[model samples]
Target: MPEPARDPRLKSLINQLQPGPVRKVKVIGFDGVDVLVQLMDAEGEEAEIGRIPLYEASMRRMDNPSELFELGQEISAEEIGRWREGQLHLSARACEIPALRSFLLSIERRQIVTGTVSEVHNFGVFVHLDGEPDGLCTGFIRVPDLTWTRMNHPSEVVAPGHRITAEVIIAETRSGQVTLSLKALREDPLIRFADQIGRVLTGPITKIIPFGVFVQLAPGVEGFLHLSELTDEPGETSDRLVDEGELITVRVAEVDLQRHRVRLCAADGEGGF
Candidate 1:
C-alpha cells in the first residue's frame, strides 16, 4: 500500500530522526516552547524522546519546562478543539465549489445590477452586490470608464454606497475578479454631440496660456485652439488674443474619441481652418 502523503513540517522531522513506534513527544526550554515529537515504541519503559537541542533554544523564554510539558499534554485537547472549529471554516470555504458554478447565477449580459459602490480608487471603482458575501460581487471601475469628463480624482465619479449599474466587462473564474464599466451603463453624450463637430460650438474659455485656450466642448472633451491657430486682428499678438471665460467660437476641426481630444480652428472661419 502507498504511504499517506505527509506535511513538509512533519516530513522534515521524520527524515531527521526515524519514528521508532509512533509516540507523540513535546519538550520545553528557555526562549519559548515547542513540540518535540516522534512515533515511539511502547514495548519497553518508554524512553524519553531524543531532543533537537537547537530546537529547544526557542523555548528559552518558557523558563519552565514543566509548564510546556503541561501544555504539550494538553495538545491533544487544544489541537482537537481548534481543529473542530477549523473544520467548520474549511467546510465553508470548500463548500463553495466555484468550478461547478456558472458565471452568472441567472442574469443576462448587460443586465443592470444596482450594487453599492465600494473602495473608489484613483483609477477604478469597486462595486459590491447587495446582501451577498462581501467577497462575492465587488468589482473594479476604471476612472476613465466612469464618465465623459476629465477626472482629477475618482471620488468625483463614485462614492461608497452609491448605487450604480455597471456593465460586467468580464466575469471569469481565472481572476474571479469582475471588471465593471459605468460608462457603458450610461448614455454617451459624445454620440449626441457629434453633430456639433462641423458646426462651431462656443463655450467659456476655461483655460488659457501661451499654448492655447481650452474650451469645454463637452463635459469631458475639450478643444485646443492653438496660439498659431488663433487669427490675428490687425497687429494683435497671440498673447493679447484670448482670455479664459471669454466666449470663443472655435470650429471643431477634428473629433478624436480615441485620444479623447478635439482639434479646433478660430471662429472667423479664417487661419486656414
Candidate 2:
C-alpha cells in the first residue's frame, strides 16, 4: 500500500492502524510465534472483531517493529521486512490480498475491553483506548451496585485516570454509545444464598432502619433481619441485636429471585412468622 492519506470512505470507523503484539505459534512463517490484538470501541472496549494474526498484520504495516510501543498503534515498513526475513513472506505469495483482507474486514464495535479511565463525565466516562479511538463511555453504576454505602461521588469508586474492567452490555454502532455493568458480572446474591438455604450460616449487620436491620449474608448480598424476628425486648434498639459486622447464625427464610431479595432469621428455624 502507498503512503496514502486517510480515505474519506473509511473516516467513520478507521482508527489509525498501529503496531500489534507478537507470540509463538506453529505457523509455517514466523518463529513459531504469533501476536494477538484487539479492535477497540469508544469506551476502550475490545470490538468482537479484529485481525486474524495481529502480529503478522502489524509487522507488515509497521516499518520499525522495535519502535511499536503498544498494541493498536500505527505500523511502519521496516517491521514488514523483518517478518519477510523470518520466512513469513506475504509479499512473495501469489495471493496476498486474501490473507490481509481478513484483518481489515473483522473490525467490530461490541466487546469488553480494559483501559485507563481518562475522565469521568456526569453521565459517562472517556478513556484513551490507545490511538485507535478515543470516545465517551456512558451509563450509570446503578444504586444497588454502588458497593460502598458511604454515599459516594462517582469519582470515589473510580477515580479519573484509573483503570477499570467493565462489560460491554450495550453497544449500538449506529449511535456510538454503550452501557456498562459491574453488577451483571456478579452472581445474583439471592440465587447464591438460596442454594445455602438448608445450611446454617452467619450474617452481619449492614444497616439499621426503623423497619429492620440489613445484614450481609455475603459480599454484595444482603438479607432483611426484621425487628420482629429479633429475639430482643420491646423498644430495644435494633442495633443492640444487630450491629454492623456483628455475626449471628441465621436460617434462610426465603429467597425471592425476581427481586433479588433474601430473608433470614435465627438458624434454629423456629420463628413463628
Candidate 3:
C-alpha cells in the first residue's frame, strides 16, 4: 500500500498566522509568477520562518512579477489561504483592506467622491479614492454612466490615472462595491434634443431591425423610424427601403419624455438612401 500524501511541516507553522494583513515580509525573489518573501517575527527585527509565496501579487493582471515587486522591498498583503502542498496565497487588491472597506461603506449615496482612475475597461472604470482610503480602489463607473455621449467605449471619456469626480449611486459594503456615475454630474442632452419635435433631421441609419430603423438624430439621441412610417406601401420591411449607414431625412413625430424616446417618420420623399 502507498503511504498517504503527507502535509508539509510548514503547514502547521503557517496555520498559526491568521488570514489578514501580513505585517512583516521582505521580498527576496520571484518564482516566475509569484513573489517569494520571508515572513518576519512580530518584533519586525528577525526572520520568523520559511519563505512564503505571494501569488499574482496584484488585482490587475501583470505581465512581469518585477512590475509589482522588487528585491529586499517590504510590503503588506492580506493572507487569503494556507499552503496545501506548499502553496500559500495572498491578495493585494485595494478592496480587501479593512479600513478601506469601512470608509467606502460610510460614503453617502449621491455624494460626490473624488478619485483617480486606476483602470478602464469596455464595461466600466475603476477608481482609486483619495484621503483616508488611498491606494484601494473600491469604486466603479459603468459604461453608460461614464458620459452623456453615446460612446462605443469608456476609454473615450477617461483613462487610467485620470482624475474624476463621480456621484455615488450605491454603496454595498458586504460586496465591497461603490458604484459611481460621471453623467450624473452633467445635464441630460436628451432634454435639449426634445425641443426639435416636428423638425426634419438627417443622420445615417445606425441600426436596422424587422420592426423599424434607428436614426441618430444627435449624439446620444436616436429616433425610431417604424416600418409603417417608412413608405406608402403598407406591408414592407424596413430594410427594403434603407440600409445601415445610408443618410436619410426624417421628421420627429413625437418626443416621449416619460419614456425618453423620440419617434420619427420619413420626411417628404426622403425615406431611403
Candidate 4:
C-alpha cells in the first residue's frame, strides 16, 4: 500500500482538510470489511450512503465491525474522501475522541512538536504531546527515528517522563497518531565520513553476521566488510576469520549517504590468507 503521507491524494486532502461538523450516520449493514451506513441530515432523516472501511472503523483493533456497531446504531464519523466506488469514505476513528481529529489536522510536516515520553516499547516510543486534548497520547517515534546511532533498546535513548522535541513525520487521523522523529533534528554522523572513502582505517569488529562483519571506524560510524573480503580462500566463514572486538584494517570501498551504509575491503598491504 502507498504510504498515506506520500500519497498525493492524501496531500491534497490535508491541504483543504478541516475538522468537525462531523456527520451523523446510521449503520445499515456490513459489506465484507466495510460497514455500510446511511448519512443523516439535521432532521435525522437518512440521505445518501457512506462506507467505513475496516481500518477506519476504530482506533483500537477489532476482528469485526459488528464488535463496535449494531444494526440501526447511530454514530458520528468524519468524511475523509469518497472511495473509488463513489460512496463517501468515512473515518469512525477520527470522531472517536472529541477534538482529536482537529489536533491532528493542525500538525504539518516537519513541524516541531514537544512531548513527554509515555512508554518505551521495543518497536517504538509513545509520547503524550503537549497541547493535545486531555487523555490523548498521540505522538510516536519508531525505533529508527529515535537516533542515528545503533542502540540495543529505546531505553538507552529515552525513558518514561523524559521530555523531548521531535519533528513531525506525519499526522495520521486514520490512526490517530503523529509520527515523530528525534533523529531528524540531529546531523547524520555518516556525513563527515563521506569524504573519507578509500582511506585505510583500523577498527575493532563490532559485530559478525553470516555474510559479513561490521567494523566501527568512529563513534556511531560503522562499515560492512563482506566475508569474501575477509579471506582470499573460498568457503571461509566470517566468524572463523575475525572475532568480535578484534581490530582489523580495512579500506573504505563505498559510502552510501542515502542508505546510511558503508562498504569496506581488505587493506591494500594486508592480504587475508
In lDDT terms, which candidate is top? 4
lDDT of 2 at 146: 33
Worst 10 residues of 1 by lDDT: 74-83
lDDT of 4 by residue, 159-180 (tens): 9999999999888776788989
lDDT of 1 at 61: 42
- The root-mean-square deviation over C-alpha atoms between each candidate and the true structure, in angstroms, is 17.2, 19.2, 14.5, 5.2
- The per-residue C-alpha lDDT of model 2 at residue 203 equals 69
Q: How do the residues 1-273 of candidate 2 rate in per-residue lDDT, one tens digit apiece?
A: 111233464444323222223222212222223333333445655443222233443323554333333444422211122333343221111112333323222323335545566666545455433223323343333434433223335565676777666554433222233445455455554554557665667767777877577777777577776777775457766766556777767777877665566787767776422
**Candidate 3 or 1, higher TM-score:** 3
Error of 3 at 124 (Å): 1.9
Per-residue accuracy of model 1 over 1-273 as CA lDDT, tens digit each:
222233477345424322122223333232333233322344523334333222322212445444435433311101111122333000111112333123433333455656788777776777775434444654667777788666578898778988887775544222234556788766555555556667778888877776677888777567778776775445544457777778777888876554556778877667722
* Whole-model alpha-carbon lDDT for candidate 3: 0.71
Predicted structure 3, TM vs. truth: 0.56
Q: After superposition, how far is residue 179 of candidate 1 from its true place, in Å?
A: 1.2
Ranking by lDDT: 4, 3, 1, 2
- Cα lDDT over the full model 1: 0.53
| Residue 24, model 4, lDDT | 96
**Candidate 3 structure quality by residue, lDDT tens digits, 74-179:** 7665555667565555554433356865685578778998988989998899988666465456889988678765667788899998999999876644335688
